[model samples]
Target: MWAVRRASHPLRSQGYRLGAFRAASTKSSFGHDVDCGVVVTCVPGRKVHVLDCHSLPLLSAARHGKSVNGGYCLWNRGLSSQAGTESSGEESELDDGFSELENPIADTNLEAKAGEGEIGEGLVSDSELLSDDDNEDDAGENELHLSDAESEESKKKTLSEFLKVIVAAPRMKMDAALDKWIEEGNPLGRYEIHSAMLNLRKRRWFGKALELSEYSESHKLLDFVERDYASRLDLIAKVKGLQKAERYVEKIPESFRGEIIYRTLLANCVVQMNMKKAEEVFNKMRDMDLQMTAFSCNQLLLLYKRLDKKKIADVLLFMEKENLKPTLFTYKLLIDTKGQSNDISGMEQLFETMKAEGMKPDIQVQSKLAKYYIHGGLNEKAEAVLKELEGDNLKVNRGACRALLPLYADLGKADEAEKVWKVCESDPRLAECVAAIEAWGKLGKIKKAEGVFEKMIESWKKGVSSRHYTSLLKVYANHKLLAKGKDLAKRMVDSGCRIGPWTWDALVKLYVDAGEVEKADSILQKAAQQGQTKPLFSSYMTIMDQYAKRGDVHNAEKIFLRLRQSGYVGRIRQYQSLLQAYVSAKAPAYGFRDRMKADNVFPNKAVAAQLAQVDAFRKSALSDLLD
Candidate 1:
């Protein structure tokens, strides 16, 4: 046996290194002369070089025999030295030259494992990891001068740049970026494909996310794992709604129909409020005999909690029968259901049960308790719960702070509200800002509310939403800070904010308080003409109520007529106000009740008493005229 290595070759410079080969004189089955040297072919990214034992013998001979698979054994040190691979973190070991160049042992082992049915679990095909070399020769035969390390570094740079472009590119340019990636002829590595999809998903660019997923599948770049499917399902639910999510599930073959897919479908059902569909999914899982896990049961329980709390008993019984252990989330959900039903005792029992089960209540549970206490008007209990929550940690949760703020506002506990605000003020969320502002505004702390507004403007990355602007405007409107209120209203309009009904009512109240009825009427008229958004019925009601209280019944009737013309059928309260206006003016309102009835609006007790008073007064006036 002889081992041969070529010292110099034109092909070596072209990125192709031919390893040593062996020759034997044994006759073969075909009965031809058997003295030709075996060829060891080495193919790089493109070109291939074939080495013959007789032509190149630059190294010493080594022991040789038939390989395990009955092929002549030959070794290649150069190919063995390479640790480069297509997948991130996975190293591909080069086989001896005796193995076929196209058939690496890594691939063979992967195939063997797949045949044993472990493919989808974690196994990825080499074809997906490595670039397709079947069409390599057809792809122009250019010699790549980059060494292994240099090639890896270049690839890392390319991936990094590609990720940056994808992330920073506008939604409109995402497709172009993907096309550029393909045009660059750089094979996308595993990390590149996964990271790109993840980034697209995070941006909620559903179309681009699906496009990248399809691109990967079409190009055989990476196999779609469970996470990929989950993300795609999430995109479908978010962008295309529940129907599309259902269709997506149908398209998935039965092999991929597992607990993960069902869980995603159930979550979408929850979001879409399709309770029946959620139940159907649970039934399907049972039909498939999929193991009833606590997670699946919990999802089902959430659906039940929203729709019919009585069904929660069924879930508990099912869990007991199935021997599925209940998680902390399950117990917490039960606690919430009890709290919502006002069964405070039941809720407390569940809390005790959770603790007995070694499920410690976290900040979320404490906040829930605080909310329950607030709902029941147990202010002291609510305060105690909040204090316990605060003592638990110096760094309070934003949600907890929001909950505490609202409770403080409702109870008129401004100092406690301020303390909660201070804890979350350093790094506040939009919700936290809104809650703090509202709490201070309710407590009649206009200055503190304004301070929070300024902080909200300065800190939130996305500028304040119209709702935030309107929230602050309410403070200005309530306090009759006419100068500031007028300026802010102009800013809101100039900034293209649709003034909320509360803000509009506040402004009208400010005008009425100032005895500027004409200005208030003009504001309403301007709001009506400004946009397709008609002023809310309450805006007109505010002005009518103001006019009625001032005994300006004619103006009140005019506003009422305008409201009816604007497609607002008067409700009981509005009708009562109108009737009160008639009583103030002593106008005959004989057919008004009939008209209200025609609109399916019945007069309340207050309107009835007003009508009776009018009737008795008319009878008395007639009697006097007869005398």
Candidate 2:
């Protein structure tokens, strides 16, 4: 990555510094591929102007003349730099919101470029994507605890020179990128580093982002404040694991160990589904006498919404006792939890209460309401919510396309889905394109889905990342187009796209659907071994379900063990699948009750039914061998 060396011209003194970089697909030593995107500048006497580095105007500056404090060159953050786009560290990984410009999808840099697009297309002035990636209040994970003014200044940081070199390769060594950036005489303002890291994290390049943060830490690149420390802890949790993050926390100054820092740890614990640890961290926060934050409480709500429903009320009680007002995410969790339990009335009451308290529902809330309505067989209510979501202009609301596509598909409204697709097609983004593919696939239009996927390749060209490929791969997997799925997988490998969890899940399904269960198992095991990415919990369950169907008792047992070893310990689906495998083999599920008990998994009626079937065959210890 050849850093665009210092612009030696006197224009540098005039504060009209120039920089150029290309964004493209590239591989890195960091164990994943990345696409770069960042170009925000504050010119002399102009409101902060930010445009994508890959925009036509920016690329023009890179190739030809270089003098765009306004149009052609990068601007220096002199006395008047404004807050650029900030992708704050996220606490909850759930999809609970959407809107006209924001998608609740796996939006990476390869997709829409940032969380909840706060700036308009082409050129944005004064508008700031100050929103972090959090589902709760925008307090986000960085918990940098910097004063608001300090954070605003940090948001102004934008790296102009290095991205040019970054365009030359898919990815590079983190140290190498940073070293080259410094060698070229780029200013390592703390916030500019934040901007670069924000761009990288928005693109889902966690590995590279962590390397940059680590470099900043070791080099003392910026003021090592609580925010930087907290942000790095969150990154370490993402790139390495909880253990590494905790170890790093040990080295922090005792004074710097604040609420934001421990809350960051609690968030990661919830993400890993480590219930015991999550509770311990929550209690630790109380023990520290830190004022409980809605963000931290929301993290628990997210975890309980996934694991155990009964515990949700207890959290609500705690919130009431603490006089904590529910955040948007808190309401979202309660509404969703209520809806999933088929408690439609309760869901409505919670949503109404949210509005009664003047908490306006955004596109995300409406989309979710429509989703639950459709799921609960209330098509009229769902349509009413959908129509309300479209508001006054379906044509203008591009963000609704993603939420609408699947909701319409589930309702069997192909015509409606096509209408949503039309709005996106007029000027498609990567997120919209991916949604169209999934929607078409769901509607059983493989040809249309394939056509959408191809057009995506044509539009983005080399801008496509492995993250985008997962959507279409899933379409193929769902359709049982094994050959097509295999070909796509090969293309992904050949193009050197990052193979993360979603792709791994799709690959497993591809072989599983085609009766190559063993092959699917191997793919999952290998992905786990590489340790570059964590496999999704669903990916493991997919293989186990197939093994049970085939009476592959031993394989089912093996996968259940693997799942536990990987820290996916509390799910009951694995237990059910293992019991089914034994029943299919006409053999006893030895110690099945004890196994569930150990995992803290209590049997529901369905699980109890499976247990009864398996227990009937519990003849003797020798019966563990065969029927």
Candidate 3:
């Protein structure tokens, strides 16, 4: 065994750095104030291995003892290397496929609460380690008393907290924050890492996700699970394109290339409408005997259902030959195909066939059936199906309710939509509530829309996301309920709901509709003050267009300047708006045109034609003066 002593110079001081790993520490995972460290051992002749004192060496049998896929109990000991403290049998390993120098703490306290009896009854969990404000007792309560269910909950909470921290911080701070998290002995294991990746994907932040993955690998923690491959492939497809994604899949190790990755790629192809590439991938899957499920086959069927319906029959035949059993999803795809081709009878036959197979039709199937009948103008058939769904002993799902609301809204059946809304009102999902509100809004039933928004807000505090708040603001704006809208906006801000571009536009439009130009300008100014560095281009354009139409060239110019200050410049539309302002103000057009030319923005037909009219007027005035 190599007994390595600390070098005279610290690693952090020696400029030792890796992916997202830098030297900064308030407290190490061991509660010691030391920075992260690694010990390098040089073997005879050629090989050197860097190891963490707290971490087992890569080739060490202890390293393989802790599998990344296995779950471990919480760590009880602190990370301090104080004398007289021994590694406990209860000490858990990092199952995230990472072993780093552990911050070892001295034996402190190990008293469980009134009803705790697990082996790890006094350990600190990954969640506790991550929490900054958590007291010693709070940490103990979480780690010691957690049952299996609570342990799962703790893991989810830990994952959520980690994501929030990374998301809230600036990109520059992300590296330091992540390093600190790992150094604190929190598990950045497979599940946690995948959770983080999914959240990033939801935000379309694939670049950041890839950065995190690189950091994980540098820390020796990256586990290439099937989901991870699929997520990365999807990110590649989105960030690059379908062609790049195809190329990427080809480069993946043959063993790692499987159904999930193929499904993701085929899905991407369907989305991009690259039918030729889709066919190639499908054929490749078939040739490799990898197309074992109807899932992959259905994706291709979806593509053909949109383009060439004749090919869909061939796909169904291929499914039979492959012995890939048709799933409920398969029938759903077939139903959609027939519906698209206006084959109402064929759609009905598929739906009945699905039910005859003992597959209880879910809300999705019911909704599709209703929609098919509705599209065929068979109103009675649509009503019968909807009535059966709503009155069935089986609970009407939010989707079914959602479908009925839109149909009712389209037909101006406010009472019917209200019935559907009542069924969906108990749903915690904001989408269901938003759909009900929109249905009312579509029918010009302002009171009903307001009632839907209010009821949802009152029912579930978590239901009212920023989108819901924006939707309510839009309702108020549309109805010119100025006082109500202002009150709601203030409440929304006070509740700490983020105001997006749509909300900003709605607020501005409300004031503008009330003929309060200065008030609209006031709200825009307030948004800018609140750190809205970049308002929507459309929001700024709306105000400028309104000001120009009113011959308020001064205010229009102010909005134009605001857009430019917000880092939007050299756009033809912006220059055209400013040019229109000059025309309305009856100022010289030549100066504005020259400015446009300087910005390399030539006038479009509309602006050129207006300028031509202005030039003719100027010439006539000069000629009359000379006469």
Highest-scoring model, lDDT:
2
Model 3, span 493-579: residue lDDT tens: 898887876688888878887778678888787887676335666567667777877767788888988876764554555666666
lDDT of 2 by residue, 41-125 (tens): 2233332212111111111112222111211211000100011122111111223232111121122342244444332211111
Output the TM-score of candidate 1: 0.52
How many clashing pairs does model 1 include?
A: 0
Q: Where does model 1 exceed 4 Å of error?
A: 1-164, 167-174, 185-187, 196-203, 392-402, 423-431, 461-627
What's the lDDT for all of these models? 0.55, 0.61, 0.55
TM-score of every candidate: 0.52, 0.72, 0.51
- Judged by whole-model lDDT over C-alpha atoms, candidate 1 comes out at 0.55
lDDT of 1 by residue, 315-357 (tens): 4434544556667666666555445545555456556656766
